[model samples]
Target chain A: MSPTPTTATPSDVTPARTGGGRTGGLRLTALHTRAQLLETVRVPIAVIGTVVFPTLTMLFFVVPQPFADDPAQATAATAQISLFAVMSVCLFTYGVGVAEDRALPWDSYLRTLPVGAGPRLAGRLLNGLAFALVSLVPLVVVAWLLTAAALPADRLVLTAGALAVAALPMLGLGLWIGYGMSTKAALAVAQVLLLPLAFGGGLFLPPQMFPGWLDAVSTWLPTRAGRDLVVSATTGADLPGTTWPVLAAWALLTAVLAVRAYRRDEGRRFR
Target chain B: MSAPLVRLAGATRRYGDVTALDGVTLDVPAGQLLGLLGPNGAGKSTLLQLVSGLRRPTSGVVELFGRPPWEPAARAGLGMTPQETGLPPTLRVREVVDVVAGHFPDPVPTAEVLERFGLGDLARRQTGGLSGGQKRRLAVALAFVGRPRLALLDEPTTGLDVDARHDLWDAVRAYHRDGGTVVLTSHYLEEVEALAERVVVVDRGRVLVDGSLEEVRSAVPARRVRVRAAALPDLGADRALVDGDRHELWTSDADALVRRLVGSGAPFADLEVASASLEEAFLAVTAAADDRSGSRSATGVPGTSTPTTSTPEVAR
Candidate 1:
């Protein structure tokens, strides 16, 4: 109250009315990402929970095993756990994150601002992806140090591409859970869903050991499809014709469910 | 002054069968510092939500700045603080302000906003570390960060201590003096008396009174007379409240009530009279409406005849 109006120079802050165009929208999206990521990483426990488990899995389970020196098996094992890292980050980040944000009055206030939901939504997705990428670093470094998880540069790039593309379904599922449930429900759902997708989809164990029936079921799971897609890229194994289409199908279906859940949440909360 | 900044025509909002806002029509001309007065569940917050375009009306028109309230362009000049809000717990106070400011085309520098809200020192602290009063101030401060033409503040000072409340009032006044429009709702009558150029009283999702402060006060002309009395005669007042050694009575004719006390030879002293508190005035009007319609939907959910007793039970 002691301070009166002190209009800083026109250049002092973001110019008003600039949010109408594509550039301004991009800027706002980046701003949202920065703010959300800061809010997230400031809580050290959250970062550790999302980022550490995958690295630890690779360390205790993969690095010290016989597959650690076999180039093909080691590459395949590294690819599988990388998928684990991405899946863990996405599930908790979106599933738990969205539900928690909805309960925040800050979230509602942000919605009331002139910018529509596009920037904030895009920012959250980007923020999650950013963390997923970061979570992969320690695992990759450890795989390089302790395992013969060697791939030609081109194959490594291809494997990265495959993993990135395959992440869509998991991202969609996370969003679906986040928008559809309360925080407590989302946390339970994420936890319950993660292990089955890992073990059944063969992220925890290789599919070579699966009996025919489990293999049949695993092939149809999005996680298994994702695992095959990335593992083949890294190992140069025969690619299945159904891999891309299966991931695409899961992605499309979950995206629709997520959007519907979001609309329903809005109706119940404020409408 | 060119046109009403906001106009609501029979606007209604219903959560399934329970209508939060009834068919209410009102116009807020530019530059009016409006105070919305009501008890719990009176639709004051709902009305602000409609005007701010956070929720759509079920049946009627709600316009802001001559356009649909939901339009982005229409919201450019608007700032709002809902009755309940949350700040991201882990975010530093300045970062939260900056994030909200980023949405506006032109915003006051984050520093200036924090300073004006008396939050300059707390800028680096995470919002989770703030006390209730500090949090409320920051919440209110976000509304003015954009230098909005219209500020809709819902219970901005609800949790503040008197000095903090006064600080917020000063921030609001400075904005209004610069020709900004403000619409705020408060249970504190002194707040309305201090800030509102025009006042609107709402009850049962309907507007009971909409006029200058003077007109609303006159319409419900009950004066509060405070006396220290024991074993008083039956000098009936409109309503009376007792606080141990003090008896506070509301009556339009303070002179007559005092005279009657003397004539009856009731042992009373330390008599004082002022305008009836808005709480007293509001209950009298709502109670009168209750009696006219003979409806139990007045102050207390389960109807009772005692207006003074019923109001305090609901107001807090």
Candidate 2:
């Protein structure tokens, strides 16, 4: 015969206390982020596919160009590529990742827990952020080592802030796509949206090169708004007056859609 | 009745035309190892889903710790293992345990939890690498990591070997001994017999019997009756089938069944009867109930056809 102890005793478990909400939520978020990151990183393609292309594009196209020696052009190019890196990482991570998680029964189990979706959402955001930062490293390093890009430490700091702000819409859009679509659909949408956003935003080619119609239409896109704000910050160029409002509007729209999609996604599936 | 830890007052859930849970009212006090015993599609999963807040009842009240089960706060003391849940394939078992344990205020050490569930050796393996039985055990173990007041397991030892099932039963028993309440659902009468002090048999979206294990056993009969008769009348056996002049019946009261058989003047012979081991009786009881209800009650769903009054199907 053996005497074994259970983790909880009846007397101690009388709705006495829930995990301290503020601290416990934060801790749960951290753990979720850690778990998501571990799972994602183990599949190298998930991280590598997002990080490699931006750095490769910079090395092959921008760094070899004559504009490689122009500080303004070089700095602007660096910022654009950096934005692409953030966009890709955020979109694929959330769009593909969230859809993948949604397809899992584990997700249903997690949703059933007393902890709401807050921690999981926060954790996923953090996971996307980590990869986004990682994807930026190679492109930024190429810009610094091979190009005539020059900026003060503060300017670099400003680029980071602009990049973070620029990442907001992509994050929301990624989340929206992730929660709203199945994995195959999300992967296709994330891929389909990537190049158009990059080209229209003048990330690969400057807006001055755009046709009259595209230049007019391009400015309305979130990617264009992000590029304008980031390019202005990096090159000391004048930011269009409409940039902030446009980006903010898209951010608001997509964030709301993402949240709503997530809340309803499980209900619709289980129903 | 110290205000039962879980209270479902006439909880009913309907999916389209299928009434998955039909007016089920039950109270579970703390520390009770209550088994929801039923056949497939007997609404066991739906009942657990209602209590776990995965799905709300279409009608009636479902409460955990006095609050509606749908509220996230009300789930604070509850843990659940759905019948077939996935483990994130790439993470090592230890990491998964630690991450889930992080959700609790006071968590069991990951290593200890692993050891208790015989998963210590598997701590470093990716969960995707685990065999089905191991994955099942790990899933069951995670429920205890949070030290929850209530654990809802929908067929926890489903894929395990008999040895594995026994090991898991001990772990569950230990948890119950320490005052953790368990509400497990299984189609297996044997499984229910092994772990539950209280048992509730559900069929066709209704609770057919609910009582302490001994009380249920004494009330339900598991006797098998075999007799050759030229003709047979309605003896009211829980289950009856005749094959080419040979009669087979499982009766709760074999003595009365015999008297009824002879008094009917059917000219029967070759009498034989046997009793004990509860599955036959349990199946008979549910089977008889199934017959009383319309055969369509087997699956209230609008489509799909399964044989009605199927004891074998129910046992499956």
Question: Fraction of true inter-chain Cα contacts (below 8 Å) kept per model?
Answer: 0.34, 0.46
For candidate 2, lDDT tens digit of each residue in B177-221? 887789988756688888999988776666767888887766676
* Residue B300 in model 1: lDDT: 22
Q: Each predicted complex: what DockQ?
A: 0.34, 0.37
In model 2, residue pairs whose N, Cα or C atoms come closer than 3 Å (at least 3 residues apart or on different chains), thus clashing, are: none
Model 2 has an lDDT value of 0.79
Note the clash tally of each candidate: 3, 0
Residue-wise C-alpha lDDT for candidate 2, range A13-98, written one tens digit per residue: 43322455533677778878888888889999867888899999899779989999999999888888889889988788888888
Instruction: Provide the TM-score of chain B versus the true chain B for each model in turn.
Output: 0.82, 0.80
Give one digit per residue, the lDDT tens place, for model 1 in B52-98: 87788989999987777766557767788733347888999999998
- lDDT over C-alpha atoms for residue A103 of model 1: 70
Worst 10-residue lDDT window for candidate 2 chain B reads B295-304
Best by TM-score: 1
How would you class the docking of model 2?
Answer: acceptable
